[model samples]
Target chain A: MFIQLVVSGLLLGCIYSLISMGLSLIWGVMGIVNFAHGAFVMLAMYAAYYGDQLLRIDPLLFTPVAILLLFFLGVLVYQIIIQYVVDGPYVSRLLATFGLGFFLINMAQFLWSPNFRTIKESMVHGVWKIGSVMIELPKLASSLGSILVAALVFLFIRKTRTGQAIQAISADKMGAALMGINLKRIAAFSFGLGIACAGAAGSLLATFYYIFPDVASLFGLIALVAVALGGFGSVEGAFLGALILGLVETLGGYYVDPNWKYALMFLIYLGIVLIRPQGLLGRGKV
Target chain B: MMELVRHRRFPTFILLFGLFIALVFPWVVRDRFAQNTAIFVLMYGLMAQAWNIMGGYTGLISVGQVAYFGIGAYTSAFLYTHFGINPWIALLIGGLITALFGVIAGYPVSKLRGRYFSIATIAMAEVMRISFSNWEYVGAARGIQLPIEKESLLTFQFHSSRLPYYYIILFLFIVVNLVVYVLERSRTGFYFRAIRDNEEAAAGLGINRSFYKLLSIGISAFFTALAGSFLTQFSLYVEPDYVFASSISITVAMVAVLGGIGSLGGPILGALVLIPLSEYTRAWLGKQGQGLDLMLYGALIIVFCILEPKGLMGLWKRISTKKRTSP
Candidate 1:
C-alpha cells in the first residue's frame, strides 16, 4: 500500500513539475507572472476532450496540436494585451493576466455549461500490475511523458543559442539588447513556449482527470506554490518543489487524517516563505 | 490625502451633501431593492477601503483576505450558538480575533516581496477553505445557519424595514473611512507609502517593514471580518465557500484599484460603479446568459488595466488638468 502511494505521488509530482515549469519560465524570462497560466491549462483540457470525441483524435495524438494552438494563443495574447501594459504599473501585468484568466474561465462556463467532462478511455488506458502492486498505465505514461518533455525543455534552455539569448535577456534586458538580442522576439517566444508547456501538461492530465473550468485554479494554486517553493523564476527549483510537495501531500494525507493534507502543505509553504523567501535553490536578491 | 475633489473648499460641502443624502435616502426611497443595493454599496465600499490600506498604501496585494473574512464570520457564528453571545457584539469579537490571525499571517507573509507574497496569499486562502470545509465542528460543508429569532436590537435583528441594517453598515462605512482619513495623515501612513515605494530605502530611513505591514493587514483584516460578521447576521447563515472564495478577495482588490488605490474616496467611487453594475447584470443575465456578468467584469478589468491602471481618480485628474490648460 505504501509503495503504491509513493508511486502515485511521484507521478502526481511529475505533472505538477511540468505545469510549474511553464509558469516559472515565463516569469523568469519576461518578469511577467502570467496569471492566465491556469486558463491555458483548462483550454488544453477542453481541446483534448473535444479532439477525442468529435474528431476521434486520441489525446496522445492531440497533445502536439493543442500545444501548437496554445503557443499561437500565447503569442497573440502578448501582442494584443501584454505588450501594451508590460511597462505600466506593477499591478497592470497582474491585472491584465488576471482579467484574461477571468475571461477564459467565464468563456468556458458559457460555452461548456460548467459541466465536468471526463474521457473514459484513451490510447493510454488500463493498468500494469507487478505482483500485489497495481500501477495505472495512463498515469505512468503521463509521468514519463512529462519527464521527457521537461528534460527536453531543460536541455533546450541550456544547450541552444536561442536559450542563451533568452537567458541573456532575463539576466539583463538592456545589456542583452546591446548584445543584439531581440528582446521582444525572445520574450514572446519564451511566453509561447511557457504556455505550450502548461498546455502539454493539461493534455496529459486530461487523459485521466476530470475536466472543468475551475480545474485549472486547483492545479494553478499548486503550481504557484511550487514556483514559490523553488524560487519565483527557477524552473528547476519549481520542479523540485513540486516533487517534494506532491510527496508530502500524498504521504501525509495517507497518514494524517487525509482531509488535513492541504493544510499541512500550506504550513510547510508558510515555513518556507518565512525562512527562505529566496526559495530552496534560487539565488535571487529577495 | 490631498482632499477629495479638485479644490480645498469642497470637502465640507461634500461631507454635508453625503450625510444629507444618507439621512434622507430611506425616506425618499421606499423600494426595498434600492435600499438593499445601497447597503451593499456601503458594505463592499468598506471592504474595498480596508483592502486599500495594505494593497494600495503598503503595496501588498494579498489575494488571501477572504480567509480572514471567513474566519471572522465563522467566529461570530460559533460564539453566538455555543456561548449565547449576540451576533451584534460578536462583530467586534470576530474582528479582534481575525486581527490576531492577521498578525500571525502577516509575519511570514510580510517577508515575501512582490509576486511571491500574492502567491502565498492565495495558498493561505486555499488552506483555509479546505480546513473549513472539512471541520465538522463548524458544521463542515453544510455551513451554519442562524435561525431567525424574534426581532430585537440586541440580536441585531429587525424585520420592519431595511433601515436598521442600512444605518448600521453606513455608520461602519463612515467610521472606516474616517480611520483611513486619519491614517493617511499620520506618521504611520507616511511609513506605509515609503515602504511601498522602496523597501530598502524605507528601512534605511528607520521605518520598520514587518511592523507597519502587520499594522496595515491587521486593520484591513478587522474591517473585512466585521463586514463578514455583519453579512452572516444579515443573511442568517455562514458558509465556507461563500465567504472564503478567491473571487471575493480579487473583487475587493479590483474595487480598490478601479476607484483608485491609496486614495481616500477611491473605494466609494468604485463600489458605487461596480456593485450596481454587478447587481443589475447578475439580476438580468445570471439566469438567462450564464456567467455573462463575470465575463463583463473580466473584460472591464483588462480594459481598465490597459487604459487607466490608476483608475477613475487618474481619469478625473487628467480631465480636470486638461480643462485647466485648454481654457
Candidate 2:
C-alpha cells in the first residue's frame, strides 16, 4: 500500500515539478514572480477541455497549440506591463502580477462560471493491477511525460546557446549584458518558456483533475511550496520538492482526515520556511 | 503671530474638520445602504491604517493581516456566544490575543526580507483559514451567528439602525489615526523608517531590527483585530470566509498602496477613494452582470501599480510638479 502510494506521489510530484520550474526560472532570471503563472495554467486547462470535449482534439496533440498561444500572451504581458516596472520597488512587481492574476482568474470565472469541466478520456480510467496493488495508467503516463519534458528542458538549458544565455542572465543579468547578450530577448524568451511550461502542465492536469477558475489557486500554492522547498532556481530542486510535498500530502490524507490535507502542506511549508529558509536546494538571496 | 497660526492652525483645522465630518456622516447618508458604506469606509480606514504601519512605515508587505482580523472576529464571537460577554470588552481581549499571535508570526518572518516575507505571510493566512474551517467549535464552514439582542452601545449591537455602529467605527478610526500620528513622530517610528530604508545599515547603527519589526507587527495586529471585531458587531455574524478572506488583506494593502503608502494620510485617502468607488461599481455592475466589478478593480490596481507606483498621492505630486514647472 505504501509502495503504491509512493509511486502515485512521485508521479504527481513530477507534474508539480514541471509547473514550478517555469515559475522558479522566471523568478530567478527575470526577477518577476509571475503571480499569473497559475492563471495561465488554468486558462490552458480550459483550452484543453474545450479542445478535447468540443473540438475533439486530443490533449496530447493540443499541447503545442496551448504553448504557442500562451507564449504570445506571456510576451505581450512582459513587454507592455512587466518591463516598465521591472526596476521599481519589489511590491510593484508583486502587485502587477497579482493584479494580472486576479484579472485572469475573474475572466476565467466570467467565461466558465465556476464549473468544474473535465476532459473525457478512456485511457485515463484504465488501471493496471499488479499483485494486489492498483496503478493508474493516466497518472503513470503523465508522470513519465513530465519527466521526459523535464529532461528535455534540462538538456536544452545545459547544451543550447539560448539556454546558456538564459542561465547567464539568471546568474547575473548585468554581467550577462556586459558579456554581449541581449537582455530584452532573453527576458522575453524566458517569460514565454515559463508560460509554455505552465501550458503543458495544464494539459497534464486536465487528464485527471477537473478544471475550474479557482483550481489555479490550489495548484499555484502547491507549486509555490514545491519551488520553495526544492531551491528557488534549481530545476532538480523543484522536482525533488514536488515529490516531497506529494508524499507528505498523500500520506497526510491517508492517515488523517482528507479535509486536512491542505493544512498539512501549509504546516510543512511553515516548518521548512522557519527552520530551513533557503530550502533544500536554494542558494543566494531568497 | 501669523507664522504661529500657520504652524498650529492647519492641524487644528484638519482635526476639527475630521470631527465635524465624523459627527454628521450618518445624518448626511440617511439611507441604510449609504450609512453601511460610511461605516465600511471608517472600518476600512482603520484597517488600512493598521496595514500602513507594517507595510508602509516598516516596509513589511504582509498579506496575512486577515489572520489577525480572523482572530479578532473569532475571539469576540466566541466570547459573546459562549460566555455572553459584552462584545466591546470581548473585542479588547481579541485584539490582545491577535497581537500576541502577530508577535509569533513576526518573530520568524521578520528575518526574511522582500518577497519572501510577503509570500510567507500569504501562506500563513491560508493556513489560518484552513485551520479555522476545520475547527468546528467556532462554527467552522457554517459560520457563527451572534445572538441578536436589543441595541446597546456596550454590546455593540444594533437592530436596524447604522448610527451606533457608525459612531463606534468613527471613534476607532480617530483613535487609530491619532496613534499613527503620535508613533510617526516618535523614536520608534524613526527606527522603523530606518530599518525599512536599509536593514543592514540600521543593524550596523545598533538598531534592533527584530525588536522594532515585531513591535510594528504587534501594533498593526492590534488595530487589525479591533477592526475585525468591529466588523463582527456591525454585521452580527462571524465567518471564516469574511474574516479570513484573502480579499480583506488585499483591500487593506490596496488602500495603503493607493494612498501614499508611508504617508500619514495615505490610508485615509485610499479608503476615501477606493471604498466608495468599489461599492458604487459593485452596485452598478451587480445589476448588469457578474465579475465586471472585479475586472475593473483588477485593472485599476494594475494601472495604478504600473503608472503611479506611489499611488494617487504620487500622481497628485506629479501633477503639481508639472504645473509648477510649466510656467
Q: Each predicted complex: what DockQ?
A: 0.69, 0.63
Give a tens-digit lDDT track for model 1, residues B16-135.
688789888988999888889888888889899999999989999877779888998899988998888978788899999999999887888888888888888888888889889999
* Poorest stretch of ten by lDDT in candidate 2 chain A: A116-125
Predicted model with the maximum DockQ? 1
Q: For model 1, what is the alpha-carbon lDDT of residue A79?
A: 84
Any idea how many clashes model 2 has? 1
The sequence of per-residue lDDT tens digits that candidate 1 reaches over residues A1-286 is 8888888889989998998999998888888888888889899999999999999998877888988988898888888888787887777678788888888888888889788999979888888998777899998988888898788888999899999998888788899999999988888899888999999998988899899998878777778788889887677799889997888788889998788887788778778878899888778677
Per-residue lDDT tens digits for candidate 2, residues A211-270, read 899887787778877887777777778788888888878788888878888888878877
lDDT of each: 0.85, 0.83
Off by over 4 Å in 1: A131-133, A159-161, B1-12, B324-327
